[model samples]
Target: MPGIHPTTYLFAARALRDFGDGFVAILLPVYLLLLGFSPLQVGIIATASLFGSALLTIAVGFLGARRNLRWLLLASASLMTATGVAMSLADDYWLLLVIAFAGTINPSAGSVSVFVPLEHAALTREVSHAERTRMFARYSLVGALASAGGALSAALPDFTTGIGLERLTSIKLMFVIYALVGIAGGLLYARIPKRGASHETSRTPALGPSRAIVLRLAALFSLDAFAGGFVVQSLLALWLFERFDLSLAQAGVFFFWSGVLSAFSFPVAAWLSRHIGLINTMVFTHIPSSVALMLAAFAPTLPLALALLLVRAALSQMDVPTRSSYVMAVVTEAERAAAASFTSVPRSLAAAASPALAGALFAASYRSWPLVICSALKIVYDVLLLMQFRHLKPPEED
Candidate 1:
C-alpha cells in the first residue's frame, strides 16, 4: 500500500459504481417485467445497452487517447448520473429502449464501461510492474465486495411494503441511488492531479505498437464475452426464477454469495499468477469453472444447481484483474488506454448479441442450453488463449 498511488480514490469510486451495477443487474429485468416487458424484451434491451456502450467506448478509446483521462472519467460519471435519472423517469417502450442503448446500465455483474479503459490506464501508471496484479486484485476485491452489498440491497423491496412503498417504486429508487453514486464518483475523479494525465506527447493510433497483440487478445476476449452474454447475471436470475420458482429476495441472497465467492478468487488469482504466470493461472482455473457451469446445466434440483453455480462463481472471475494487468504489462504506457479499449470494445460488442438469444431460449422451454453453450465456448476460449499466449510472458513473469 505504501507504493500505491493517489488513485486509491479511483478504486473506491469503481467500487461504488460496481455496487450500483450489482443491484441494477438484478433489478433491471424484474423492473421491466413490472412494466409488462417480456423476457425477450428484457434481453433486447440488455443487448442494446451493451451495443451502445461499445460504440461510446470506441469513441472514448480513440479520442480519449489524445486527451486527459481525468476529464473522460468525469464525463463518464456524469453520463452515469444521467442514465440513472433517465431510466427512473422514462416509461414508454421506445424511450426506455433508447435510454438502454445510451445509458451506463450494465446488465451484467462486471465492469465494461468507457470508464474501464481510462481507469486502467491511470491505475497502471501508478503502480510498479511487480505490484500491478496485486493492485488490480485489491481493486477487484473492493468492487466485488461492494457489489455483494449492493446485491443484498436488492432485498429492499421485500421490506419496502412495510412502509407502504410499491415494490416497483422501491426498485426505481435504486436507480436514483445509482445517480447519486455517479455524482460522488465524479467528485473523486475531480481529485486526480493534472500531472497524472497521459504519458503520451506524440499522437498515437488507438492500437499503436501493440496493434497485433491487442487484436489477437481482442478476438479471443470477444469469444469469451459472447459466451458470457449467454449467462449474464440478469438472465441467470431470470432462469432461476422460471426454472425453480425463485423469489426476488432469494435471488438476491444467491447473487450476494456469488459475488462474495467471485471476490475471494481475486487475491488467490494474484498469488497464483506469481507462481504459474498470468496466462496459465487464467486458463487452469477457468476450465474447472466452465466445467462446473456445464454440470450446473444438468443439475436435477434447485439446491444442486445452486451449488454448481457457487462452484463456478468461485473460479470464473480469477482472470479479471490478471487479464487487465497482463494487457497493461505488455503494452507501452502510451498504448494502455487504446489496448484496454480495443480489447474491451469487442467484448462489449460480442456480448451484445447473446442476451436476447438467451431470452429467446428461456422463452421457448426454459431449457438449460445457454449454460451449456456458455461453458463450451468458454472452454474453447481458454484453450485457444493458452495455446496462443503461453510463450508471451509479462516482464514480471520473467
Candidate 2:
C-alpha cells in the first residue's frame, strides 16, 4: 500500500465493494423468494435500498465538501458491513425491508451507494484533465472485472449445499461474506491519505457557477436511472428465473460473461471518446444497447434473449466512465464532489421509484414489460442527452 498510488487504493476498494454488489444484485431477489417474499415485495425492498442510498449520498455530498472524504468513505463502508449483517440475521419481511432501507445494499448492476461520489471525487483529484477520462476508464474496468468475478461467486451456495450445509444456511453465508468484504474495503479506505486543512479551506461551495448545468444534467440522468430501475440486475435475474427457469448457477455464469463484456468496453469507450467526443460516444453507443435490450424483450428463446442481453451489456455501460469524466470536467474542481452527488442523487431517487412498478408488472403476468419499458425510456434519454450536450465539449475535447 505504501508504494501504490492513492487512486489504486480507491480502485481496489471499488473492486471489493462491487464484488459484493454484483452477487447481491443477483442473489437478493432469490434470497427473498426463498424466505417466502413475493416479487412485489422484492421490488419494494430494492426500491427502499436505492432510495436510502440516495439520501445517504446526499448527506455525504453536503458534508463531504467540509469533512475529510476518507472518513466519509470509511463510514459508508461501516454501513455496508451493518447492512449485510442485519440482512443475514433477519428473515421477517418487515425486518428485512427495514434492513434493506437503512443499509448499504445495492440492487443494481452498478453501484449507487454513498461510496460512489466520494470515490469519484477522490479519483478526480489525483489526475490531470488530459488523463481523467482514461483514469476513469481504468476505474470502471477494475469494478467491472471484480463484479464479474463476484457474479461467478454467486454459485458458492450450490457448492456449500452440495457439501451438506443447509441450503438456507449456505445462502445466509453469502451475506456474511458480503459483510466481510465491507470490512476489507474499510481497510483499503483507511490507507488513503487525507487532504490537509489548507485544501479544505479552499474547497468551493457546492454547486456554484455550475448549478444550472448540474441541475439539467441531473434531470436527464434521473430519467435514465428511472428507466434503468425497471431492469436492475435483481429484477432482471427474477425475470430470467420466471421466464426461462434459469438456474442460479446458470445466471451467475451468464452475468459473469455479461460483466466481462462490459468490463472490456471501458477502454474502448475511452478510445472512442477521443475520436468522436464524449457526447457522441455516450449517445451513439447507448442507443444500440437500448435497441438490443428492446429486442431481447421479444426474443422467443432463452439463448436469443441471453445473447441480446449480452450485447446490451457490451454497449450499455460504455457511458459510465465517459459520463463520470464529463461531469468532473465541466464543473469547477471545487464543485466536483457536489456535482457528482447532485447528478447521482436524482438518478438514485428516480431509479428507486421504478422497481416496485416493474415488480407489479411481473406480478400481473406482463413479464416483458420491464425490459421493453427500460429500453424505450433509455433511448429517449440518449437522444435528449445528445441534443442538449453535444455543443458543450469538455476542455480536453476543445
Candidate 3:
C-alpha cells in the first residue's frame, strides 16, 4: 500500500466500473427473462452488446494510443453510465435494443483489451522490465478482487428488498447505481496528473505477423471464449435458474464464490508460469477447468454446479494476464497496440456469438450442449497453442 498511493485510487475507480460490469454481466439475462424474453432473444441482446462493443475496441486500440486515454476513459465511463440510466428507463424490447446500440462508447473508449495495453505502455514509461510483469500481475489481482466484489454486490438486490422494490426494479436500480459510480470513477481518472500516451508503440505497425498470429490465436481463443460466453455472469445465472431452480440470491452466491476462486488464482498463475511457461500454464490448467465446466452441465444440484464453476474460475483466467503479457513480449513495442487490437477484436466477436448460440441451444431443449462443446473445443485449443507458440519468446531489450 505504501508505494500504491495514486495507483490505488485509480485502481479503485477502474474497479468500480468493472464492478458495475461484473454485476450487470450476470444480471442482464435475468432482467430479460423478467421482460418475458425467450433464451434466443436474450442471446441476441448479449451478442449485440458485446459485438457492438468489440468493433469499438479496435478503433480505440488504434486511435486511442494517439489521444488522451484518460479523457477517453472519462467520456466512455460517462456514456456507460448513461447507458445504464437509459436501459433503466427503457420499457420495452425495441426501446431496450436502441439503448443497447447507443451504449457503444468502447469503440473510442477504454476497454479491457485496450486498457491492458494502454496501462502496460503507461507503466512501462516509468517502470522497468523487471517490474513490468509484476505490474500486469497486480492488475490481474485488482480486477479479480473487483469482479468478486461486484458479484457480491449483485446480492444486494436479491437479499435486501424489504423496502418493497420489485425484483425487476431492484436489478435495474443496481445497473443504475453502478453506472453512476462509473461516471464518478471516470471523473477521477480525468483528474489524474498528466502523462502523454506511450510514444514507443508504432503509429502504423505492420499487421502481417500480428494479424496471422492473432487470427490463429483468435480461432483458439474464440472457441474457449465462445463456449463460456453462453455462461457469462448473466447467462450463467439463467442457466442456474433453469437447471437448478435457483433463486437470484442463490445464483449470486454461486458467482460470488467463483470470483473468490479467481482472486485466489492470479498469484498461482504467475508462479505456474515460472515452472511451466505461459503456454503450458494456459493449457494444462485450463483443460481441466474446461472439463469441469462440462461436468457442471450434468450437475445434479446447485451446490455441485457451483463447485465445478469454482474450479473453472480458478483456471479460466489464469491464462489471461500471462497471455496478455506474453503476446506483448513477443511483438514489437510499436506493434503492441495492433497485436492487442487484432487478438481482442476476435475475442469480442467470439464472445458475442456465444451468448446467442448458447441461448439458442438452451431454447432448443439442450441447455448443456454449449458446456460440452466448450470443453471439447478448449481441449483443441490447448493442443494448438502449445504446438504453435510454445517456443516463441520475446527478444531481450538492449
User: Which candidate has the highest TM-score of all?
Assistant: 2
Pairs clashing within candidate 1:
none
Candidate 3: clashing residue pairs, number: 5
Please say which candidate is ahead in lDDT: 1 or 3.
Answer: 1
lDDT of each: 0.90, 0.93, 0.69
Backbone clash count for every predicted candidate, in the order shown: 0, 0, 5
Q: Which regions of candidate 2 are displaced past 4 Å? A: 196-204
lDDT for each residue of candidate 1 in 1-398, tens digit (9 for 90 to 100): 34545677888899999999999999999999999998999999999989999998888878656888888889999999999999988878899999989989999979778788988888888889999999999989999988888888988887897899998888888889999989999988888765433445445566777889999999999999999999998899888888888998999999999999999999999999999999999999999999999999999999999999999999999999999999999988878888899999999999999999998987888569999999999999999999999999999878
Q: TM-scores for all candidates?
A: 0.97, 0.98, 0.89
- In terms of lDDT, the best-performing candidate is 2
For residue 155, model 3's alpha carbon misses the true position, in angstroms, by 2.2
Error of 3 at 177 (Å): 0.8
Per-residue accuracy of model 2 over 97-129 as CA lDDT, tens digit each: 889888999999596888999999999999999
Which candidate would rank higher by TM-score, 1 or 2?
A: 2
| Cα error of candidate 2 at position 322, Å | 0.1
